[model samples]
Target: MTKPDLAKRPDDVSSMFDRVSRGYDLTNDVLSLGVTPYWRMRARRAIDPHPGQQVLDVACGTGTVTRILADHGSTVTGLDFSHGMIEEAIKRHGDHPNITFQQGDATQLPFDDNTFDVTTVSFGIRNVQEPKRALAEMLRVTKPGGKILVCEFSHPTNGLVNFGYDTYMNVLMPGIVKLVSSDPEAYDYLFNTIQAWPEQATFASWLREVGYEQVAHRNLTYGIVALHRGTKPAA
Candidate 1:
């Protein structure tokens, strides 16, 4: 099956997520075998969240990455376009004074320029209708000299592993998602989207094209996931 073009108009993008909001996290964990949390841990370490820094966690479904950033002493504002997802994140993480959950579109953020010390997104960029535009917004909100960090899925370069990984994601993962979620095809689209996502180097170059400096990327778990980072230029 061909991958769905996730980069589309706002209305189409919004509707896809509204349907998946109920089972996004559960399907993610099942597909990743509960290792998505560890992937986020590596992303948190790479970003080096610090005290007094304000961070934005874009597409912060269920506040997974938001809570991690908060635990590292950074003030985190988690945003998602899906109202149900944002409400879930708020219910889960909003009690903490350091973490705020809100509904916002990635292509059009609500904050002013350089409003945050760091901006991060986990497993969300691929779903954005305009990834380049969304990345630009991330750069816009991040102060000069701060970080724009990302953690997302990527296919393996190793041929043998790629074959096995594809089998698992396309076959077994969907079965599991079906068991856990009524929205079974939503996870299927996730598999499709990740497979269609650009390579790690391609994404890093996209960040550079969006005006991010010091861009770097590291593949984790044999290339099933990748963590990328870019820093805003200091004046």
Candidate 2:
């Protein structure tokens, strides 16, 4: 499920998200059965960002994880290609000086080599047309020994669970999205991408191949969600 080399490029996906930005978070909460926030908290746990540390959250749609990580004591910069999402993030969290939202690309992050103490991308990598390139950028910005945390909807292993989740995402969620956002088709695409995401083993191997060492993953909620973690070695 590598997405068939999507004709929609990275910028196209970004634009699609921007168009649906207003209702995006709400849609996630409803569609995922209010578990998306719990997933974010778990992703932060995987990264284990510390006080006074600098962390970057890529594809930070409305900065849920960004603000959460900031509150945990790290100075966080939330980057997204969608201006609308960034605007919403600022509108919601601008009162916190530790959290800053900016417009940036995931595959081509606007940061120097080895700059961040940690980096995290929650439910974002699947939207990138070039996921490997974004992963490389994430590794490039992470300081030696720093962790890269990724939370994604990995394809379920259990047949029964997968069937139920797919029913929710593919069958039930579309109707919900239609009422929530004008671009219901975008949410449909999102569901399709989730189904098409690479399995956990392949993704962990990909992370190691991209130069992230100590790769590991943990399943959540009966394989409906997963958190993958890796670290760059100090030279």
Candidate 3:
């Protein structure tokens, strides 16, 4: 029942996620019309993690993408601000020797500089109260020449598609969430954040501003989602 406002106060956001931790992954699948997994696949491909790589998955809810990264033989750390979400992730993936779940703030990652070979967040950064700071943190933790990929809901580029997608988000999604989500009001916050998120190009600029180089993005699902990629400059 608890929902955070657009201000995105960390405690409020964390508590809201905790309230919705139960069935959260299933709710995402239903709300995204089963396309959530595909989006994650695209993100993983962008990073292309390898054996012995250290990858950090920020705001990893239930360790879905974390497990996907682990499947590639990478050692993945799944971090989330919500304790309940971390608990769910550990419950689901605790046995995976390659994956570890931790509760931490995105803006202040609890890791040493240049620690990870790759850092990524799927459908999570927009929830951070200070996304720019979080991006900087991601950049800070990534080793020189390492990569970062962000997969998030984005605005459609084509007019017709945009119209249809807007209608679906504004008109159809609310009703669907009410029916399927364990905490329906939390999705109201979700809708607001998606609407308020920056467009693809602008978001890519955030990575550039945070010192990532070779930044670029590709639209997926008619730009209803976008995957942004960047690399840390070699020291």
Each prediction's RMSD over C-alphas, in Å, is 2.5, 2.8, 1.2
Among all candidates shown, the one with the greatest TM-score:
3
Model 1: residue 7 alpha-carbon error in angstroms = 4.9
lDDT, residue 50, model 1: 82
Q: What's the TM for model 2?
A: 0.94
TM-score of each: 0.93, 0.94, 0.97
Off by over 4 Å in 3: none
Q: Which stretches of candidate 1 lie over 4 Å from their true place?
A: 1-7
Cα lDDT tens digits for candidate 1, 62-177 = 78889988998999999988877887777777899899888889999999998998899998898887899999999988888988888989868789989989888767877787
RMSD of 3: 1.2
Query: Mind giving the per-residue lDDT tens digits that candidate 3 earns over 138-190?
Result: 99999999999999999989999989888988899989998998788899899
- Choose the strongest candidate by lDDT: 3
How would the candidate models be sorted by TM-score, starting from the highest? Answer: 3, 2, 1
2 or 3: which has the higher lDDT?
3
Evaluated against the true structure, the overall lDDT of model 2 is 0.85
Ranking by lDDT: 3, 2, 1
